[model samples]
Structures are given as structure tokens and as C-alpha cells.
Target: MSNSSNVTKQFSAFYLENRLYGIEVGRVQEVVRSMLMTPIPLAPDYVCGLINLRGQVATAIGLRQLFGFHSEIPQDLINIVCKVDGMLISFQVDEIGDVIEVSESEFEPTPQTISEDIRKFMQGVYKVSNSLMSAIDVDNIIKFLNNKLK
Candidate 1:
């Protein structure tokens, strides 16, 4: 067995519907407060809008809608900026949390109980304190969405 499984990895945490979600820290460019977005006409429901960060533009994806959430969109949404397929994309989440470190040994396969909508995008889960953090695979999501749009 390889010792690489024992390595510790850090994740940027966020919340949606009171459930914890995370993404590998290295993949995250930065998290920022909501910015003004230019709405895209005829776009899917999950596409919130396009945001201009400094001089760069990023497509903001509503994680809530993407995850099939039905709750009212919160007043203050956070953006998790990431580079996917050489393009900067922003994932809009409900709230932001601290950076969390968990050993690779702590990683577990996605629970069989998770809904398929969410399970498809989750790489796995890590048990942290009293909660389990589902790791989001941003690239996987983008690829799926791209194929979906094609």
C-alpha cells in the first residue's frame, strides 16, 4: 500500500442547506462576496450570471440550483472562484466556512444515501468534527455541464 493515502489535504469549506461542502484548496482561486452579475438570457436555471472580477469575467454557477435545491435563494451568496478548463468560473454558494485539513486516510467513498444529483459531483467525503464534508469536483461538474450543453 502507498503511504500517499496518509497525506493531509486542505479544503476550502462552504455550506448549503446546512450541509458542509468542500473543494480542494489548491483548485480554489479565492472566495469573494457577491458581485454584480450580467444576466444571460435563455441560459439554464443554474447559470446565475456572469461576473466581472477586476478585468476578468467569470461565469457564476448557482450551486443551489445545480444541486436541485428548492430553498429560496439567500440574500448574501458567496463566490468560490476556480479555474476550470482554462476558464475562470465562480461557484455561488450559500455561505463560506473556514479552511479545513483532513488526512487522505480519512477520506471515504460517497455515501450510498446521497442523492444522485449531488453524488455525481462529489469526489468523496471526509469526516470533520461533527460533520461530513463532501468534496466537490469542480472540473467534473464543468465537464458534465459542457457535455450537457453540447
Candidate 2:
């Protein structure tokens, strides 16, 4: 079983504040620099707004606000566009990192020390060289947001 779980997968890493997080590279559509966002009135606080990505309207989400962080979003943001349930959603992150290939053996369950809000959306944690990278579950995130919107 352990040997079966040792398959390697690539993840696109990004930063929220100082914390590192990652999503499966296959789920990521593209990463774009800061772009003009059109605010959606009556939307959840975490929903930053909408961005036109190559003529497609993508819903932009404020990753910090979604994680219950009270700090203001930085002026320069990097948006990681991911396809969840056939829909494209953009996650605004503080900084974009590299695409790291990690083996399943290096993945561990999320620790209890992590805050409740963040823990809910994480699939697991990967033991990187210098720091732990929390794996973000895009499906769960989309489900949660859909529930909130309903």
C-alpha cells in the first residue's frame, strides 16, 4: 500500500502571507499578474470580484479573506486560475512560487496546530525541503463557495 502511494505528483506552490500552500498542477489553468477586477455587489467578502481572462470571466477569490485572515490584500496580487467542476475560478495569492514535484510518501495529514478554518480546506501537507506546504483541495473550496453563494 505504501509503495502504491509513492507516485509523484506536481504541485504549483503559492504564498498567502508567510505560509506556503499548493494545489495540484493539473488543476491550475494559468497564473496571471495583477489585473483589474470588477467588484460584485452583495457577494461574499472572500469573493474579491471578477476578472476577464482572455475574454472569459473568471471569479476571483481573496485567498486571505477565505482563510479568515483580517489583513488587507496586497496591491500587487498573483492570481492562480484553477478549474473546479468545469468552472474556472481564480485565487488571488500574495506570491507565486515554483511547480514542485513531490512524492506521495512525503505527504502527511494536516497537523492539529493549524487553525480550524484553514484545516477544513486542506487535503494534506507535504514535507518540503525548508518548509511544509499545505495542499489546497480545489473541489472542496469550490463546494464551500457554492454553498456560501446559495
Candidate 3:
């Protein structure tokens, strides 16, 4: 028996300094614990330099830098890596959260009053339980890198 009307995509939520952030699980290649970052000279503040991720050079990006936040990043944080535009890009997040699934109708528009930094990175908001997890826009993040390189 095949049901013709039951389909839903799953999402993984991560906690970046207590705020809920969601990303499509399919986009994620792997998640690993925080590792020592080798700083690169003349690199933008956001680029924490490259890390030797199992023989692969993964560019570590500080989420804090992307947001222009002045707060200090914790000493212990992990890098979430994924293949972005054929290059391995790793994001520095506070910690990995749970994976949740919901109907397509659950996606909601982001609040207009959200901060410019947050707004720029998120596609929309996913209301999960008591908090709203901003869905990370993969394309937007890639666009940011392009703009920076220009």
C-alpha cells in the first residue's frame, strides 16, 4: 500500500549560543568536535583559518564574525562541515542540537523586526516548541563568501 499524500522533510537544529538554528540534514556532510584552529595571516576576521580535517583542508568560519558580534567565542566549540559549491566549508557552532521534522506548511516567515545580521543569514523561521529556529540559507552564505572575495 502506497500513500499518495504523506511526505515531509527532516531538519537538524543546532544551538548557536542558545539560539536555535536549523539546517537541512541532507546538506550536512559531517559534524565533529571542536579542534585547534590554525589562524591565517591577512585573512578576514571571519575566516578563522583552515583546519586539517582528515587530510582535507576545511576552512573554518567563525559564526560570530559573520554576525559581527563583539562577544567572545567559547574555547570549546565544534566545526560543522559541508560541501558548499564543491568546496568544504566548516561553520563554527556552539553545539549540535536535535533533528526535527515537520510538514512543509510549518515553515513561517521571519519576523520583520529581526536583527539585520540574523536576517541576512536566515531564509525563514521554523517555530519549534518554545523557540524559533532560523533556517540557514545555504545559498545566502555562499553569496556572502562571493561578496567578500570581490
Which has the greatest lDDT? 1
Query: Each candidate's lDDT (Cα)?
Result: 0.93, 0.92, 0.80
lDDT of 3: 0.80
Comparing 2 and 3 by lDDT, which wins? 2
Q: Model 3: per-residue lDDT, tens digit, 57-90?
A: 8888888788777777888877888888788888
Least accurate stretch of 10 residues (summed lDDT) in model 2? 1-10
Whole-model alpha-carbon lDDT for candidate 2: 0.92
Q: 70 in model 2: Cα distance from truth in Å? A: 1.5
Residue 138 of model 1 has an lDDT of 83
Runs off by more than 4 Å, candidate 3: 1-7
Q: What ordering of candidates by lDDT runs from best to worst?
A: 1, 2, 3
Clashes of each: 0, 0, 0
Model 1, poorest ten-residue lDDT window?
A: 141-150
Q: In model 2, which regions exceed 4 Å deviation?
A: none
